[model samples]
Every structure is written in C-alpha cells, then in structure tokens.
Target: MRKWLVSVLLLCALPGLSGVCHGAGFKVSEQGAKAMGMGNAFAAQADDASALYFNPAGIAFLPGIQVSLGALGILVPQTDFHGTTPLSGTPPLDTGTAVVTEHSRRDIVIAPTLYASYALENLPLSFGLGVNATYPLSKSWDDSSVFRNQVQIASIKPINFQPTVAYRVDALNLGVAAGIDITYAMVSLQKSLYSPVIDPTAPAPPFGAYEVGSLGLNGTAIYMGYNLGLLWKPRRDLSFGLAYRSKITLDITGDANFLATTPTGMGAIGLSDSALFPYTRAHASSSASTSITLPDTLDLAIAWRPTDRITLEFDATRTGWSSFEKLEFHFDSPQFAAFNNQPDPRKWRDVWSYKFGAQYVVNPRLALRAGYSFDESPVPDQTVDPLLPDADRHSFSVGTGIGTTLGSVDLAYMWVHFVDRAVHNQEMTTLRGSNGVFKSDAYLLAANLNLKF
Candidate 1:
C-alpha cells in the first residue's frame, strides 16, 4: 500500500514538473496584435506602444504618450493519438493487442496584454509599463481514456508585469533599454491512480487491473527576472535590434488530495491491516513543494525599407532550455517522507526559431501585413508525454491595420501546425500510459487598440 501511495504522489507531481520545463513551447508570444500579424518578428521595427514588450529601446524614438490594449484568443482542436504502450491493458491482455486510438479535449484560451509608454519632450529618455500573460495552458483528456492515469487535466496561468526605462544616443543613432519582470503563476492538475497488482475484492483469481483513486493538486509561485534591449540604425532605411530576457527560478508550494473510487479495493486492504500498511489511508491529504527554473531567451533581428510604403524584417530567437537539468520535490507530511528529495534528470536542449515578416502601407488610413515562422521543439522524445506533447511547428499569419480618429485598430489571425511526433520513451510503466503518435494544431486571433495622447 505504501508503494502505491508513492506512485500516486509521483504521478500527481509530474504535471508541475513537465509544465515548467516545457513552458517555452506554451509561451504566449503574441503580446501585441501588430507583432502577431508579423509572426513576432517586430524586434527591429518596434515603432508603436507594443515596443515595450518587443524592444523597449524603441520607446525612446516615440513622440508622446501612448497606450495599447490587446487580447489573443486561441482555439486548439482535439489532438489525435494512436498506438499502444506497456500499461495499455490488463494482465491477461497483451500490450500489442491493446492498441487503441484516443483524442484530447478541445479548449480555448485567452491572454490579454496592456502597455503604456511616455517619452519626455526635452530628454532622449522614455518610460514604459507592460502587463501580459506570458505562459498560459489548458489541456485535458477523457476520464475513461487510455491516458486517464497519465493525465486527466492540467492548467497553468501566469501574469508578468514589466517596468522599463530607455535612453537614446541621438548622435550615434542608438537606443538602450532595461526592464524588470515580475511574474506570478498558478497551476492545477488532476489524474487517476492505478494499481498494477490483482484486486483482492474480485470474485475470481487473476483479477484484472483497476483504478485505486484520483489525485488532485494545486500550486502557486512568484518569481522575478530582468530584460535588456538594444536598437541601432546606421542608415535611415535600415535598423538592427537585440533583446535578452534573463532566467528565473520558481519555488512552488501546494496541497494534494486523494479520493478513492471504491471502499473494497486496495483502500479496504490497507484499512483491514493497519500494522503492515500504517501509511496507506484511502482519502489522504498532504502538503508538497517543488522548484523549477524557467529558461532565458535571446532575440536578434534586422529591418529594411527599400520604399516608403513597404517594410520587411527577419528575426531569430534562441531559448536556453538546457538550463532545465533537474527536478526535485518534497513532502511536508511524514507519510510521504519516504519519497522526498529525489531528483530526476531532464536533458532538454536549446532550440531556435526563425521568422520573416512584411508590411505594406496602401494609404494613410490602411496597411496590410503578412508573416511566417518555423519553430523547433525543445523537449526530447525521452521526456515527452500527454501533459506536453511538443513538436516542431510552422506558423502563418495575416493582418490589417485601420487608422481611426482616436488611434489605430490592429487585427491578426494565425494558424499553427505541429509536426506529427512518434514516441517510444523508456519512462513508461504500467502506471503511465503507452507510447504513441501525437498530432496537433491551433488557431489564434488577436486584436489591439492603440491610442496616442
């Protein structure tokens, strides 16, 4: 019974572990509608209020006070999975014969952002503030699906507040900026626990595998980091930009709850014998803690304008996912002390993304934009799971800007297609689900209102 309890706790903690390590894949890059329309390649052409997030230094070139309010709506279709794993079936059923097809739940997620900047009239200095949701996720599977024990539901919501200052060297056509990033995150997960051993309550011998109970966890954390940006333009028609965001460590504290499905199964066994299974309580609760390191990111880009009506830009972004090397957890309750302070190695590697975007101004009140990007997956096959089935992806976007008397309204639409992934991980046991192929895709729509005062 103690062994089963340890297994349940470990499984319950995995959502928090994997969610932070692979957050780069789920990071909300579309903080501004203009940038999203340009495939997030606007670092060099950051001319509007949203520049506070893309390239803070650009604020130094602005004329007066500006504000931007925007929101991104994301819709992910159901992800398809097919294949079999070690724990796909009961004892009598062969793993190969238990092949099955499953689909993840369809969900929509919305992330909002706000940015305000002010440029002093007499000084070449600017101050700005930004609030946005940088990491947001909502994923789930059916209760009776093959992956029920692996992950039934997982949700992560994070908010970031940034205050920035930028100085411009007009003589050298250069601008430099720095900012602090204060982030708060909340996470929740739910999954079922499975017992590999035969059920003693069964009427016959060779009792089939069954579920012990369900486990739920809720956690919250707060962390701080910094970001820096540089923008240089040697000529009127060309510009270069560089941006860096530092890493942060989040120490999370939460509580776990267990609810048994039946009173006669393993729960009754432990209740019937207290001496041998003193720690095996059917409905148990405990306090838990864990820490994870979020990776840093670097962006480099260039923008060019061959004609007054047209502009083009290209950008490359690198994420230092290699920083996520290990994960550890602790339980404050004595019953779970046996499995505390164990470290697990995660060999995630660094990855890069390339983006290209173009903008054409047709008139004073109208503009059109289009962009494309290719992003690489950071999670290795060994660590991939239903909680985060990441893969290489391609994104395409288009948008329009409408100038109004008060300000401007920008609208963008993007489609992301993830490459199919096939996994044969060694981490699978009868407790976790089997290896399989996963295919996924998503659609995003964004709108922003920019006002100049």
Candidate 2:
C-alpha cells in the first residue's frame, strides 16, 4: 500500500513545462509601497513586520500589530506558433514534403494572496508571521489537425500556501518558517489520430465522434520547508538585507475521474481501445493511485534606502527544477504501466530571476512606485512542446500608496514582455513524433494592498 501511494504521488509531477499559463513566474511581492519600490528585498532590512518572510530578525523593530490584504490579476497572456513542417509520408500524401502553420491561443489565469502579522510589545525580542502562495506549474495546448494529430495535454492548476515567523535585534534581523503545501492537480489529454479500418467509401466518422476524459485528483499531504534572512544598517544612509528560502516536497493524492466521453464499443464498458485513452475511471474505481513531488527554491535579495522618501531594491531567485528530471509511477493494479511508462515528455532545467525597483514619496500622505525584472526560462529548446511554451521574460511595473494617522494602504501594476522565443518542439506518438515550431507574446497586470493597526 505504501509503494502504491508513492507511485500515485510521483504522477503529480508528470511534466515540468511553463507556457504562458504554466511557465510564468509567481509575483506575490504586493506589500507596502516602500517594499515594492525596493523590489521586495526586505529579507535583510525587515522594515515592517511583513519583513519576517523577507527576514524574521527585521521584525525586531515592528511596533504593536499589523495586518494586510491584497488582490492581483494576471492579464490575458498570449503565445502562438508560426513556422514550416517537413511533409513526408504523412496522411493523404506521399513522403518528402514540408508544411507551415501557426500555434493555438492559450488561456489566462487570475490568482490572489493574503497575509497578516503581530509583534511582541514589551520584549527584547520580536516575533512575526504571514501567509502567501507560489506558482508550481501549468500547461495548455489545442491543435489536433496538425502532425501527430496533436491533442491538448494540459496539467495546469496548482496552488500553494506558506506560513512563516521571525526575530529581530537593533540593526539586524533573522527569521525562519514552515507550513503545509497543498496542491490541486487536473490533467486533460486526447488520442484522436487512430486510423480506423472503417470503409472510407462507406462513411466517415463524425468529426466530433472521438473519445475524451478529464482526470481530477487531490494530493492532501503536509510538505514542510523553511527560510532564513539577515538585515544590517552600517550607517543612517547605508543598509543591506539578504535571505534564503529552503525547498519543499509536496506529495499529493486524490481520485481521477472521466468527466465526459464518447463511447465506442470496444473495452469493458464498450469504449474504444485507443492508446492515449486514460483509464482513469478504471484506475480510480480499482483504487489506482496518482501522485508527484513539488520542488524546492532559493531567493536572495538586497535593498538600499537613501532617504525616508526614496528607496531602491533588487533580488535573485533559483528554483529546484533540476529535481524534476524524470517521472515514474506505480499502482497496486495492472493499469499502472499504461499510465506510467507512457510518454510524459518533460526535462526541466533550473532557472534564475532578477528584480530591480524604486519608490518615491510625493507627499506625506501619498507615495509612488516603479521597477523592472528579468526572468529566465528553464525549458530546453530540444524538448520545447506547444503545450508548455516557456521563454525568458522582462517585466516593468508601477504603483502608489497612502498613509493616515490610523495606518496605510498601497497598490501596484506591472507589465511583462516575454522575449521573442522561437523553437522547434516535437509531439511524440507511438509510431513516430512530429515537431512544431512555436512563437509567442504575453503580458501581466497586478495590484496589492497593506494595512496596520
């Protein structure tokens, strides 16, 4: 039973590709305008109680209690392909030919996060806590008439929650945190290129007459990890901050079901016996388990506040993508091989992200913000598939805030431009695999709010 459970969990980490939907970076740094201006390098400075996540020790200066809430919207991202294909012995023709066309459009995702903090009043030491999320993975592709009769194979929709704590001294701060990493996974795919022996002269199967299914699963296991940071102020005008976030491994488990399908008398339930057909119903009914591991990551940052009204920040991050080189699955039932050994094309590489930002106070009650960042892609060119269209990107952002006798509030917006990425990606099949060269453009718009009492 334990081994079976392991197999189910591994299935969760199926393929590591980040298209506009899956490959995009997580931008959860919607904190105070002061933090956003400096590109969120609070790990070492811990300017506010929220700095605990950035640097627990920074919380040493935070007075009383503070709470915050914010909303972020990732605008409609866009990615498409335009290129040529070598047409050889393919359907309705002979060998030695080339074809060219465009890739399909992808969907948009909107996600949000919330946080709160409290500081110890009359103690030499201070403590604080917060909650947020990270983008694990996603995929979406729909181009069936092309080579390999490609069908969208998307394993998108994963969300994570993080809770943490910190401690502080005069000019230096340090902190650590741990929590449950819950992930909801859903995978959809199709095998629509079966050359049935049906009499071509007799009749053609209705265009929509194909087999399909939706697999929904939940992995409810507690994954644990921690983070560390330091902040120092050598002088009034000179200060520095640094932080390290540990890695986490999430083992998820849930049921896989067939949401919809067109039956063709063939299997136990009179369904067509096609290769790509996911025996999810059979696997679920028979207690077939599916699972996978979420990788770990590291973040380093720095901030410089020249004046009480002006500040600057920068950061660099690395994700444990190397931990996802390959995937393997096992079930207590025979259906395991069909689902495990099957083609799950994914070989993701580690990635690094850099951020630089600035904030200016226009007046005592209002402030403004702006910044830029460069993020690298982990997807290799050789394995670049249409489903997981990932590429390097550049982001530009701006925002503002308001202060009152009671507390303060902040908001920000960003625009991300993915560098022009053009590559040849192949979709593999049992008999053979066909390649698709893709190109795309994407954008993101985000906002955040903060409060203290």
TM-score of each: 0.91, 0.73
Candidate 2, 178-283: lDDT as tens digits: 3333434333333222212121122244312122223333333344556665556666655566656555554444433323222221232223434365443322
Clashing pairs in 1: 85-434
Q: Least lDDT summed over 10 consecutive residues: which range in candidate 2?
A: 194-203
lDDT of 2: 0.48
Give the Cα lDDT of each candidate. Answer: 0.79, 0.48
TM-score of decoy 2: 0.73
Task: Name the top lDDT candidate.
Answer: 1
58, model 1: CA deviation in Å?
Answer: 1.6
Q: Report residue 381 deviation for candidate 1 (angstroms).
A: 0.6
Please write out the lDDT profile of model 1 over residues 314-411, one tens digit for every residue.
Answer: 99999998888767788776656665776666678899999999999999899999999999988788767787788998999999999977789999
- Candidate 1 versus the native: TM-score? 0.91
